[model samples]
Target chain A: NAGVTQTPKFRILKIGQSMTLQCTQDMNHNYMYWYRQDPGMGLKLIYYSVGAGITDKGEVPNGYNVSRSTTEDFPLRLELAAPSQTSVYFCASSSQGGQSPLHFGNGTRLTVT
Target chain B: GQQVMQIPQYQHVQEGEDFTTYCNSSTTLSNIQWYKQRPGGHPVFLIQLVKSGEVKKQKRLTFQFGEAKKNSSLHITATQTTDVGTYFCAGDVTGNQFYFGTGTSLTVIP
Candidate 1:
């Protein structure tokens, strides 16, 4: 059913460049999140949205921004990319805030030179 | 800030052997969820535990939640090659974010 979809499976950016990571879900979930995973490390939360027109900062929101303009879309934006920002980014959605299982997208691998 | 930690970063077990991974949270959690990520794949939900001192089993796998709601564990009996993956424990605190543990990478050898 295409639970969650992330665009641009892979991308490369030079320092100071900007790009957007697109995420969309078809399950009509209320909670969406953005996370980054470094090699051999756990997923770190970047930004999250409880519902349309509502967003909040997560554990690791630096150098990233997010917007939830509709129920089906939550996009992450990277401005002035840095080497430290190079990592695999994942998008997830859940039916509720807690106690619900999350549906995740395949993820986008980004490299910043 | 809440944090979840997992032990035994890597584990290798022969087929038919048992495997276990532990997770601890620095703060009390409202609920704990387990996920498995296969090689080159996104995390997939496995189970969720909410009650204190709760124990649940799914076929060959067993899951337990600490009495204080700050720790959890997952044990697998008679492991197989299909069990190879990185297991992660994610805790939900204050009803908002899901903080994930470092994860335990398990390998089942034939």
Candidate 2:
């Protein structure tokens, strides 16, 4: 089974472009997270959802928004992309709480110029 | 804020040599998780430690969580070229968010 799937493997955006990064999971997990990793740096959490219809901001959620419409889909939206937003974004899902291991997607590489 | 800090941001070791990366946190953690990311690849789950003084092994790799539950380490015995990757430690202080450590990038020279 495809544990986690993220769409638009790669994208290039202008200074003020808006886009959405799609993420879905087939594992029926209740916990999903969106994280971004800059060059040579540790990942920073952007947003996380504990279950459907419940979303919260993480450490770096300034330019991003997320919505958990269904248990299988959690999409991250970039309202106004900036150059600083260029990084590799990963979507992960865990079957339970933090005690469980996360299943990560292949990641979406976004380059904002 | 940076809650967790990892030592030796980058490591270059010859094949067959031993390699170690450390993760230290000022606050107590309920559990710790380890992940490895190859160059140009996403991070992949490796192992997890739950007990205060837990230790787990995988073939040539060993993972240990400190007795205080604030520190953890990943050691690779007889490193190989296939082990070249960036290792990360994520600590769970609460059940909500997962914060990552500084991260250690390992480069094996074969």
Each model: TM-score of chain B? Answer: 0.98, 0.97
Per-residue lDDT of candidate 1, residues B54-74 (tens digit): 999999999999999999999
Question: Which residue ranges in model 2 land beyond 4 Å of their true spot?
Answer: none
The local distance difference test score of each candidate is 0.96, 0.94
**Residue B83, candidate 2: C-alpha displacement in angstroms:** 0.2
TM-score of each: 0.99, 0.98
Clashing pairs in 1: none
User: What docking grade does candidate 1 earn?
Assistant: high
- Clash list (residue pairs), candidate 2: none
